[model samples]
Target chain A: MTSGDESRPVTEEELHAHADGLLPDGRRAAVEQYLAAHPEEAARVEGWMRITASLHDTFDEVLDEPVPARLSGLRPPSRLWPRLAAAAALLLAGLAGWWLRGALPGGDAYREAMLPHRAAVAHAVYSPEVRHPVEVGSDQEAHLVAWLSKRLGTTLRVPRLGPLGYDLLGGRLLPGDRGPVAQFMYADPAGKRLTLYVARAESGETGTAFRFSQEGAVGVFYWVDRSMGYALSAELPRAELLRVADAVYAQIEKVPG
Target chain B: MSDRDRIVELIPRLRRYARALSGGRGEADDLVQDTLARAFDKLHLWRPERDLRVWLFSVMHNLHVDQGRARRARPEVPMGGEALLAPASGGPGDVLERQRLIRALEWLPAPQKQVLLLVALEQLSYDEVARALGIPVGTVMSRLSRARATLRALLAGDGRAPTLEVVR
Candidate 1:
């Protein structure tokens, strides 16, 4: 071996190799000899050794403590689309009941009857432009698509909404009752914003449905398609909101087969 | 208990590995929990013949990588510098040392860190680590060498010899 090899001192790689139990017998012996001569290095290595021991001590107890009941309990195997359909059915029934009670007029009547206005309340609480606005951005559209597709097991096209004077801002992958959902954002020229949250249904069925409500001045619209759901919300006028909904539907419909 | 239950039992071990890899940040717990939840949700995909702990580790590893990629794609928002440097509380000097070990761990490159953790902390064989990381055994060996050398340098302070006692 060259002098360079001899004086090189046991490298971090070799120490890691030694730590990992990967060094060959001969090299390991050499390293041991080097360490014998080098007290400071020995202490450092010993520190890491202690660190491993400490980690086991600190967290290993979690194993013996009973696993959380919710985690351990048997959960009924759920079909993705069917559960989604059941939820939608319950929601529609609730909406129909409310509509009958009020006897309101037109699609606006149905819109007012069933939308999740609380989501708008949540949106306003979390949506100021700054850090942590959305988990994923439009620049990584490819990754977002792949991830959401894998989770939902369906090809999700990022709907184009240029005609509504809105451009794709970004999207986030969120957990839902069925699986993961993709939430896409669009912004108009004046900086007004809207979000399209999409997820696969637990069942396969198609129908035109609408739910609407007002929360702190924000109008919310939600709908369901065959094996999918969409929610749209903003502070825009009801008519303008419907126009945006139409644009969202048209673009989503054009998602390539 | 079924295979899924057995897999669930391995969560704590997976969490320990994740904590070592992540410098004992609570983020590691989240990583392990997410892995377990995903594995449970997709239990059908797991093959029965494989080791459950190894499979869980693989899931944790992938989730860590995906999260890392997502973090990198976003603009870096600076957290306070002191928060980055403060040692994790709890335990004794040993705990502090462990935190140091993990911080030193962050100094190594990602590939070396992965190889070192799998082999050293998890005590996987070189072959097992290679399979877990989808790298060759030789690459695992070399990477471990580099990782240990770097750790020794960092810990021992500037190219000093390392004191290692062979376990008889």
Candidate 2:
């Protein structure tokens, strides 16, 4: 083994490179020697290798799953005519949507109507997480509120839920159709979790009345309060979820001006 | 094969990366669709001299960032629990251990997760991950180390607080 640097102890970074098999030929032998002299370090390095091995075993199968058709559906760039046609169709859809807005029941209500659907979707997306239910845990409630407020361009608050037996789990920032969204998660002692998705309401979108929607086992309570749209979604029965929603609304509505 | 055919062949790898990135199959499909569509639309903008795979991944990464900015959040979907837990051949202990690993992975911060996935999962070189993420190679190295350490701590039950098991 070529030992160019026999006197120097191997660094942690070099050991990591050794574990990942990225070490140069000269350094590889030195690292092997270092590990040989240290059985405990060898065990730790073995664990890292196991982590990578397990990760590969677990997810490498995904590479074999057939690519979904929709992802590969678009015609190649050589098909200029079809691409132009598709672009034109998208334009027409935009025009049609704009024209239908006036004909539809109050335009703002239609937007409001979609918020609960989004809430339900987001709930379906996040509620079953075995871990990582929130971006900022309750320990950083103050920081979460401040960060989300800056992102959404509105002062945000985390509603207290102690009385309802649900404690703040944390909150995560999400992409909304228009702008940023803030979703706060809470869970009861039994591990049943609920989420509150909040986003800035579009200008002229106004409503205080709570609307409800149910999807599968999930129920959503959504409403617009001036410039904010709030959706509370959980797997509880309608009445029980509504009670929690009412409490959430009351706590948030009292956010100091 | 033509460049278009080359891209088609790369779809499965892209899908795999998207699956790991998004954490949910449906959301992964959406990301792939959006990425492929955007790549096709912007095909002319691609320089032929560039590595097409890296360019495509950069496109996907940028698109993901755009989507995140517009929506202001990473994907919120939980992986389907039943599918993961039902590994058929693995023992219950192995299944739980795998589940714990998945959970720990999900808890990683996005930047570290991105670097770790690119380097470890996709087997990309540090330079390639840096180019794809538009970060320095040094940053990639640091993030990879931190991610591995964090996952180690989490799996060893040292980093996270222990919770009482809820009895049904």
Candidate 3:
């Protein structure tokens, strides 16, 4: 939101276009100056450039795969893609999710508070979504854990709360503070949903005190264990949620994080 | 070459897009199959001056949208997200990052993903992407920006959350 106004030196769209190579050459110098002055914006632009390059690296060779006979001679060809998408050789992926907050003015505490807010936001956004609730389902718990664990660069265990009458629904990777976060969802028999959000604990802060934040009707109990942060969110009585949070904390505590 | 003949040659290109679009080989081929069927059926409606490749993509795009609508109507079986398997290929270089990119692209919303794939993968300019997707150039830029930010978020920290649906 910083430079959204067209009157600014460089607007958000200009940064996107510049990173995307869509910005005209005439405007490139000013953007370079803008990015030079803004380290965060530069990091974001670098991250986008990396994404564009990786996309080329991954699918550019798709044209080389053998075409199935079923698709042959049936319809016209999309033919050759005109260009090979060269020119954006990038080095680092860079830190992300600040762009999620977008040029908003926030201090360290506000940035750290994004953990609970994101957890609650993800819960509210996905909890009511019936058809596409999670990226992976509990039926494929092993794969789900492996995928999410690898992405988050940590060993993760989905808390088993079946005895507590809430079954694990699944989990999804979400954009959040510092890096990607994981949300493991659960649902009771009556279809009431609960979400537990996890992210890597900010370095230099471990075993932080347990904190509760009420985001609208959703109550979130968040705490930072060694190297990992957890937030359990649900729309229930605080005592009831506290019970589940304690259970989740205790269960995950056994895993050595 | 005849338009039909040209389409036959471009089937592989369409298949490539279908794979990125659908994420499942079987489902993607099914989409390409349907696109071919529709292309042949509506061959007469195509204008001679328009770029046939772009026109054919529009055909496939329409089919994808319709299939999405049909999938939404049948809510009995929720989408299981089983379609999101990162295709295992490529040399040792950039294997993980590349896989993450594919998975990230699959995870993006359809509108944003389409704009990005058309512009990045297909080398279509903003105007060309708009023409192919039947959206304005400004709309194309906006979608591309959203898609870029999402990819940046996903790629930066290896977050690849994907979504999918099918009538079956």
Worst ten in a row by lDDT for model 1 chain A? A70-79
Q: List the candidate 3 regions with Cα displacement exceeding 4 Å.
A: A1-8, A75-257, B69-92, B158-168
lDDT of each: 0.62, 0.74, 0.73
Candidate 3 at B87: error in angstroms?
Answer: 18
What are the per-model DockQ values? 0.18, 0.29, 0.32
- Model 3 gets an lDDT of 0.73
* Candidate 1, A71-189: lDDT as tens digits: 34222222234334444554555456667877563445444333353245334533433334466777787887787777778888777778668887776666664567667777787
In terms of lDDT, the best-performing candidate is: 2
Indicate the TM-score of model 3. Answer: 0.47
i-RMS for every candidate (Å) is: 4.1, 2.6, 2.5
For DockQ, candidate 1 versus 2, the one ahead is 2
Per-residue CA lDDT of model 3 for A1-257, tens digit only, reads 22434335788878877876788876777788888989999988887776666666766576788876556634332221111111011001001333454534365655566667667766766776544678999999999999999999888899999989999999999876578889999999877889999998777778877799776667889999887889999988999999999899889889853
Candidate 3 residue pairs that clash: A75-B7, A75-B8, A76-B7, A76-B8, A77-B6, A77-B7, A77-B10, A77-B11, A78-B10
User: Residue B92, candidate 2: how far off, in angstroms?
Assistant: 11
Model 1 chain B worst lDDT window (10 residues): B159-168
